[model samples]
Target: MSSTATPTVEIDPQTVVRKVTRNVIPFVFVLYIVNYIDRANIGYASLQMNKELGLTSQAFGLAAGLFFIGYFLFEVPSNIALAKFGARRWIARILLTWGALATAMGFVHNDFQLITVH
Candidate 1:
């Protein structure tokens, strides 16, 4: 009696690595590029904003730089909370915070208002 079995093909490890790198690296690179563009856009916007709002260069720079402080303050707490609450709920919380901040941002007229919004 003869028994037939389906063939199993073995993929080369380097080929698998190369395929994954090709697929994932493009997405990562694109995301990084987008992030860079966003930061650059804000910097350009700040130039116009400083004049319109009558903000001194130092005041505008201080307000702009404090954005990183807010991120830094929240990031660690967010990661710890995410570990406890899971991604869905944690992400919703983050989105809610962002939405509130964005809504408040619309009302900002001066540097103090901008700094205080968050």
Candidate 2:
């Protein structure tokens, strides 16, 4: 009988870290900035939207507050989903879903609709 042998390769941890940081960090940073801009855009829209929707300041405030409340409630589960689904799929799903919801916001006619959309 002949003996069989397998070869093993070693990886450099620092090199892996450097490559990950270089490749991933810039994309993550840009995504964060875009997300911030998207979230902040509602405030700017409120100038025209409040009058058009006939939303009282309090109602608008509540609607705005609910966005963050929903975010808080969903954050942990979303992170868990990201871990389960992997980043590319999870992030694409998030972007598509939020993009649809953002588009839907433009069609809302009243406080109830705005609240529901948020």
Give the poorly placed runs of model 1, Cα more than 4 Å off: 1-41
lDDT of 1 by residue, 32-115 (tens): 655465456547767777788888988877877887887788889889998999765666665566556656655678989977
Candidate 2 lands at a TM-score of 0.76
Clashing pairs in 1: none
Q: Backbone collision count in every prediction?
A: 0, 0
Say which candidate scores most in lDDT: 2
Model 1, position 36, has a per-residue lDDT of 60
Local error of candidate 2 at residue 4 (angstroms): 13
Report lDDT (Cα) of residue 36, candidate 2: 75
